[model samples]
Target: MGETNVKLASINPDAQKARDLLRIVIVGHVDHGKSTLVGRLFHDTGSLPDGKYESIKAMCERRGVPFEYAFLMDALQAERDQGITIDTSQIWFKTEARDYTIIDAPGHKEFLKNMITGAAQSDAALLIIDAAEGVREQSRRHGYLLHLMGVRQVAVAVNKMDLVGYEQEQFDLIEEEYRDYLRSIGVEPTFVIPVSAREGDNIANGSKSMPWYKGPTVVKALDSFLPNAPLVDQALRFPVQDVYKFDQRRIIAGRIESGRLKVGDTLMFSPSNKTAKVQTIESWSAREDFTPPSEAAAGQSVGITLDEQIFVERGELISHVEEAPIETEVFKARLFWLGHEPLTAGKSYKLKLGTFDTPVTVQKVDRIIDTSDLSNSESEQVERNQVAEVTIRSRRMLALDEFTSNGRTGRFVLVDKYDIAGGGIISMEGYADQRAMIMATKSTNITRVEHGVSIEERARRNGHKGGVLWFTGLSGAGKSTLAVALEKLLFEKGYNSYVLDGDNVRHGLNANLGFSPEDRAENIRRVGETAALFQRAGMLAITSFISPYRSDRDRARAAAGDGFHEIYVKADVETCKQRDPKGLYKKAIAGEIKEFTGISAPYEEPDSPNLVIDTAETPLEECLETLVNYVERNFRV
Candidate 1:
């Protein structure tokens, strides 16, 4: 960072027009000389502030200590005393090719989350490895995270080569091993060079001691990184950061996250589903009055006024309406856990994406990924520092784009209580019709069917009112037996009815689903939608399933809308074990089954069921009579 680029940019007006800029992050393990390398880069570029170098050198001389180059980045006196970098610090430097912003991230395990924050914002990265230590755990973990964040350009610096006697053989071994690991994670290193940051070899100049090794200096390698292509060809996604009203006009303010914004372009705000035309652009300046620029590209901060007054607010994404974001309550994401507590299903966290924040729950954990070798396995939870593919459900609707499509609107962070517990990227969308598929039908302009035969007519012909009776209980609780008996009794009475058995559906409609909690919820979802279809044809839909979770059952009821009956065909664990005809209870008790609800996992009892039949005590005839009488009273129109 020269004095001109660091402090005298305004005075040198010509330099401001040079828009070639790139941001890169320096990451590595603790005590691996990341700060030293950044300090060396700044020193060699003459970017340090005036008197900054002399003061540091004088301090080292007075203390009778060798001046440490890493001290330049560890600004805190306590940090220098402790010999570690605590937080991410941004330092500006320039090469003739481009202006560079280097984000020096802490390499400590505790601050790995902080490192993610900086890496997520970078266009490229420099991974520094210690030659003496070879490849460390963080060397792989950090590289994996960089790949996860979509940073493909990387340059690895093998530092502290002087400590290894500047041996070419030592550099080759370390270089080959680390390069192979990068290939496994789908990253081809732009360059890997051995350097001694402390001795200033292979940094800004060539090294004579290691004449056998030949490669571009670290500065040249960084310059070789390609600049980010212009995002103008992409769609506009200017997320609203805030709305400000200085005196009279309300200005929607935020950085253009991607694409471009210009006056007179029609824009639509997402999640809010509001639209307005951009009337004028506004920018702040030192002058009393200034002309607003005609356009604002990505990375520029500008405000705009709409032609007509609208309820514009934060958390709303701005884009062209024709290519709007997907507003949904459910999505799939790959998340990296960082909280003290492991990420568990059913627990709630706050998710913040762009300017939007909402309550989030890990509805299902598909699998946990081992960062070291990229192997994956089925996991019930993701522990701290672990990565996993999971399904997340939000309390309210959020407009999101897949990270493969748009990086800014596709990223999110999970906050457990007040601290950020994890971060993820949106991968797949669910409930695409609206926030919730069942709820969106009420808002859409979908043309309602005008059937030639009315629902009343169909019920009259069938001699019964349309309804759904959901039977839930523990396995071997006689739910299916009772449902079969009810179907016979109802059919004998000449009333239209049908039965949906759990295992029967799994054999066909839900054949692709597994026994995972997520699959179970989806199974119930499919059954609920199917049962509703039967009710639409004036039939009594009797569904027999364990239906473990109350949340899943509630969604079923909500989808049914009305005439939804929740009957708990209750039985104690011991009684179900005694009556285990299929022997599932024996397997579950012997630990042969995974995610076996009511034995291994959970079975949320309904708070207020329409009916409860304790099959262990209630007589078969008595239970049948109770259900028959209840149905006649409710559905005998």
Candidate 2:
């Protein structure tokens, strides 16, 4: 073991306060010793509990699992059983200079979603490359993801030195190759360490096996890391996370993305376009008019009290009044697709960027770039784990910042109706006009075929204004029956209502659609758009479908906009079979209908639905009453 040195001057108590904590995530191909390296570091620093190692070792032996360094990182039982890291495991350790939180990210390609979640929160990354195997697919994939996530700092660790006979030549060759690869993607490693994590060589202690190489140990290199300061010192960016109202005072809790914020400063809330003066800087401790923004820079969570009771919500940005935020409906972004399904033009998905969640569609498949070849591929779609430069058009305006400027506001994820399928970074903002121009060029002939009445006027004539009532459930479930029943009931009550059933739309509106995942997506998209139009016309639109995919439901919600109401007619598959509204379940089980939802295809229940009616338990009258009350509360007369 190398002699440990303590530099008291290097350890500053105010160091943690000076800037946001720099998070470094360790990512690499599986079995490359990422977890082992972390465990070794923890073990050397005395961070792990006393009997934890012994217990893990005993468990590994009993399970007949190969006791590698990665076993220490198998925190989850699933990870251990699968012999892979399924999720990112956060571990905190203290060095002589700073307190570091190391995120151990999984390297499996299937778990890229987990990797993105971990990398998004990191300021820096540690790329672990196995010297024996060189760079694998995950190593390259994660590298691209990190770059897309705006992680500026990176370090490379060449593990398994003992297997390579602790040869300096092998380490040098691998280092040069990886350096070239990273440099191509605009990332330069700070340091590369060659050490045997199994033998405790040069990780925390200096290794005698490799005497020719002379460089700082991994721990020393980490301590030497200096955080990058924010660019604009005068510009304050506060992204409101939540509003807390206690008694008579309203407190806004958010992290300052950039610049200085102080009490008595006038701040402007965007999207809502409201202005208010800062009353006081509220935190665990009460501060006066002198709240130094420098004292709490970007990424540091803080609370603020405003002078006026202005309406604000999570995802809204509050900044200095002079530099009001820009909101746009369309933008150009660099996207990395991770879903099993490919990303195609005209496909809709839920766009979750910052705190704003909206319905978005891919207007065009701009260009697909192969990360490995660095060449353009002329393809109609982007497949799983592929990186591409594409343009996205959102239904509503979103306040966005460039990836180079502010990562917090620039990064976004595309949820396939329910599951997050892709992650992207906003490269350019305010591309709505460009998209409009493209749309104009595509439409050679323009014809005015007005319905002769405005949507508001039509709704007024209908008695009850237009809105979308989405019904979701299992295949054999009474979603369609209930939807039709409700529409008839609304019609009898002097409300104009229309039913958009799966069977009805398949005959004409969705005639081109098939039972495939892609076709199902298109089916949902068409229904959602139609419902939106009906709602605009002031007619109640009831859509009933076995929209098994959550992503499809999310897209419908976004298309329907503010008046969209999602109702989950919750019923078990067994109960659905008992109902057998269309005799579809029997066909599905008898192999007559392939890709039938609730049989072959999956049905993801809505996570945050507006209403949930258990058709199995609730009476028809009671369910109808509950739905009526919801409509009355949500839709104003």
On lDDT, the leading prediction is: 1
Model 1 clash tally, residue pairs: 1
lDDT of 1: 0.84
How does model 2 fare in lDDT? Answer: 0.76
Off by over 4 Å in 1: 1-16, 231-233, 245-248, 285-289, 429-463, 468-492, 497-537, 541-560, 564-637
Q: Give the per-residue lDDT digits (tens) of candidate 1, residues 56-149.
A: 8998899898998997888888778888887889988887678899999989988889889888889999999999999988899998888888
Candidate 2: tens digits of C-alpha lDDT, residues 166-192: 988899998887788778989888888
Residue 367 lDDT in candidate 2: 78
What's the TM-score of every candidate structure?
Answer: 0.75, 0.61
What's the TM for model 1? Answer: 0.75
